[model samples]
Target: MAKRDIPEINAGSMADIAFLLLIFFLVTTTMDKDQAYIRNIPKKVEIKTEIIEVEQRNVLAIKANNQNQLMVRGEIIADPDKISEKIIEFYNTNRNVNDLTNDFPTYTHPTKNEIEANLKAAEKELESFEEQDAGDALIDYAYSKIDEWDKMKRSLKLFGGNDFPLINSQANIRIEVQTRTQYSLFAKIQTEIEEAIFELRDTEAKRIFGESYGVIKTRYISDEEPIDKGKLDLLDVLYPARIIEVTPKN
Candidate 1:
C-alpha cells in the first residue's frame, strides 16, 4: 500500500482578507443615533420663598397614567396626535384679546414707554444696590431684574408695534406622569409640546423676520449673529415654553 501525502492549506492571506472586510463594513455601515429631549433642570433653592398660586386658566396640565391614558386640561385625549392641537389652542386662544370668560391665559400688552420706564427703574435699583454694597443675593436679584427689563426692551423693539404682547407671567405647561407610565407616551407628550411651541414661533418668525424659526435657529447656532439672536429672543418672548415636569409618584 502507498501512503498518501496530505497537502497543507495556506491561511497567510486570511487575516488580510478579514481585515479588509472589517474595514469595508466599518466604512459602509450606518448607525442609528439615539433620540433625546433636552431640558433644563431647575436650580435648587436655598431659601424658602413664598409660593405664589397659579390660576387655573394659566396652567395647561397634561397627565399620563399607568395605563398610558392621556388627559389634557381635564379632557381625556384618545389620540396622542391631538395633543399638539390642544397646546396650540391654549396659546392662541387669548393671544390677541383677553376674554375673562374664557379659560385660557391672558396676554399683557406693554407699551414702549412702560418698558423703558421699568428698565430705568431696574437700572437705578441695581445701581443703588451696588453703591450700598448689598449682599450678593440682593445684588444678584437687582441685576436679574435689570436683565429682565432689558430683555423686555429688546423684545419690544423687535416686536415693532405699539405694544409687545406677553403671556401671563404665571402661565405654564405642567406634565404629570404616573410611575408606571410608558416612556413612549412621555416622549410623545414632550414631542407634542415641542411641536406646538415650534409652530407658533415659526409662524410669528415668518411674519416678523420673513424667515422660518428653524432657519434662524440654525444660523444663529452656526454663526452666532446678533441680529439672528435678537430675532430668536423675540420669538421666544412671544411664545415662551414654560414647562414643568412633575416627578412620578409611586
Candidate 2:
C-alpha cells in the first residue's frame, strides 16, 4: 500500500491579505494623548539654599500612611470623595493680613511695577542699615526690613496682581506621603485636589468670562483666539492653587 501525497494550496494571496490587514489597523486605530498635570517650575540658575520657615496656620498638611489612610492636619478623613471639599475649604480660608502681630505680608492688589520699586527701596535701606554703626536696635530694624523685602518679592511672584480674593492670595497646601503608600491612593487624592481647584476656577470663569474654565482654556489655545485678559488675570488671582509637596517619609 502507498501513501497518497497531500495537495499543496496556493500561498501568494495570503501575504497580500495580511498586508491589507496591517494597513487597516494602522489607519483606523486612534492614539490618545498622554494625560498629565501641568506645573510651573522656576528657571533660575542659583538654587535657594536657605531653609525658610512657613507658618503652621498657613499650611494645610495632608498625610497618607502606609495603609493608604488619609489624615488632614491630624484629623482622619473617612471619605475620599470629601477630600476635595476639604481642600477647597482650606484653600479658600481668609487670613488676617492687617494684624500688626501677623508676620506674613498681605496682598493688596498692587501692580508688579510697584512691588519692584518697593523691593529696590528695601535693598537700599538694608544697605544703609548695614553701613551704620552696629547696635541691637539697628540689627532688629535691618532684620525686619529683610523680612519685608522678602515678603514683597514673594508676593510679586505669587499674586502677580490684586484681582484675587484675600483667601486665594494667602493660602498654601502641603502634602506628605509615607514611603509604603499606594500610588493609586496618592493619584486619587491628587486628582481630587485638582478637581477642587478646577471647580473653584470654573465657577469664577463662568461668573467673569461667561464660560467655564475648560472652554476658556480651549479657546485661548485655539489659533487666532482673542482671550479676555482682565478675566484671565482675575482667574489667576482668584485661583493660585499654591501646592507644596513634601518628601516621602516612613
Candidate 3:
C-alpha cells in the first residue's frame, strides 16, 4: 500500500490571520443603541410662515395666599386639582432642552439679517403679549415662564446670538407639542386656576366689606371651615395626578 501522508496546517501565521479577522468584524459591526429620550423639533425663522415655529411647552405652577386661593401660572386657579392635571401633563422637570434645539428643524433665509429681523420681531410680539396678559390671573405662573425663558436663553444663547439655549441643538426639554395639544393643556390649567381664584373670590364676596372703600375685607373664620397648609399640600398633590395627554389618534 502506498504510504498515506498526513497534511500539516500552517501555524506560523495563524495568530496574524485571526487578528485581521477580528479587526475586520469589529470595523463592520454595528454598535449597540444609545438609550436616549426622543424629540420632535421645529424649523427656524426664515422658512417659517406667518404661523411661525413657536417652540413652547405647557407648564404649571401653583401659588396661593392665606385665602386658600390657588394661582396657576399667575391667575388664581379656582380648582387647584384641575390646574395640577394640566401642569403634570406638560411638566418634564428633568427634560434636557439643550438637546431639543440641536435636533430642531432649520429654516434658511437668503440673508442672516432677514432671519435675525424676523426672530427679533417674533420675540418682541411674544413679549408684548406676555406683558399684556401678565397679570391676567397668572402672576404665580410667571416663575415657570421665567425659568423656561432662562432655560431657553442659557440653552440657545450658545448658538451665537440666537435668543435660546446656549447649546447648538437649540434643544429645549420644554416639550413643544402640537398646537391643539398645547391649547388643550393650557385651557385645563387656566380653568383650574380660575376655579381657585373663584373660590377665593367667593369666600371674600360672600363676606360684606365695609361700606367705605378702604375698609379691610374679612371672612367668617369658622373652626370647621378653617383652611390649613396641609389642605393646600394635599390638593396640590392630588390635582396634578389627573393630568392626561388628550389628542385624537388616527
Candidate 4:
C-alpha cells in the first residue's frame, strides 16, 4: 500500500531523442538511384532571334498516343521490336536532297563482314610479325592499322558531301508522345528507337574494333579507363542519338 509516494517519469527529452534518430537515418539512407538513360542536357544559350525553317521531309516524326500505340510518320507500328529498324529505314531514305538520309556502306569498309575480315587479317599479320621479331615496327604498324580502321568506322563529325560519304549532320529525328501515355510505354518506345540507331553503330563497331557499343561508349566508359577513344569517336559519328523530344501532345 506504499504506491502513494511513486515518482513521476520524465517525458520531456523523448521527442528530442526521436527527432535526432530521424535526422540520423535521413542523413545515412541513400534514396536516389542512378538514372537509366544518359540524359544529354543542353545548356541555356541566348541565341539570335531568327526564325530558321526545317523541312518536313528532313524530319523523321514519331508519335506515341495515350493507348501506347506507336506511329512513325502517319503509319502505325504494331510491334515494338520493329520500331528501330523502321527508324533506320526512315533515317536512311534518300529520295531527294531534302529527303536524304545517312547513306553508309559506300566504297569504304562499312559492312560488318568487311571490317571483321580486315581486322582478322591485320591481327594475323601482327602475330606473324611478332614471331619474326619485327620489334617496334610491327607493333606500331598493327596498332596504326587497327586505329585507322576504328577511326574509319567511328567518326566524331558527321560526313557531308565534301567530307566522307555521310549526309547532313543536322538533328533529324523527332519524338512526340501524348500527355496521358504511360511513362513506361513512352520510355520503351524511345529505348527501341535508340537501340535501332545503336544497332547500326554497334554493327560498325563490332566489325571495326571487335567490341560491343556499350563497352566503347564515353558515358559508360571513362577517359581514365583504358578504352579505345578512336572507337568511341567513330561510334559517335556513325550513330549520334540526336533525338529531340517535344512536349507530350495528343
Task: Say which candidate scores most in lDDT.
Answer: 1
Backbone clash numbers for all candidates listed: 0, 1, 44, 2
TM-score of each candidate structure, all chains considered together: 0.85, 0.61, 0.20, 0.55
Q: What ordering of candidates by lDDT runs from best to worst?
A: 1, 2, 4, 3
Instruction: Give the local distance difference test score of model 3.
Output: 0.39
Compared with the true structure, all predictions reach lDDT values of 0.92, 0.67, 0.39, 0.66
Error of 4 at 37 (Å): 0.8
Model 4 poorest ten-residue lDDT run: 100-109
Q: How well is each residue in 151-212 modelled by candidate 1, as lDDT tens digits?
A: 87898887887897799988999999999999999999999999999999999999988889
- Report the lDDT of model 1 for residue 20: 100
Using TM-score, give the best candidate's number: 1
Prediction RMSDs, each to the true structure: 7.8, 11.6, 27.1, 14.9
lDDT (Cα, tens digit) per residue for candidate 2, span 43-95: 33453568767656566777888998998877899887888887776654433
What is the lDDT, from 0 to 100, of the residue 165 in candidate 4? 34
| Model 3 / residue 68 / CA error / Å | 33
Candidate 3 lDDT tens digits, 1-250: 9998999987999999999999999999878976532223332334333753534322233443434454544565575466534443333232234233332323221233444554565566557767788654344345444544433333232223433111212212222224334444444444654454334333333342212111212221223233322232222221222223323332
Estimate the overall C-alpha local distance difference test score of candidate 4. 0.66
- TM-score, candidate 2, is 0.61
RMSD of 4: 14.9
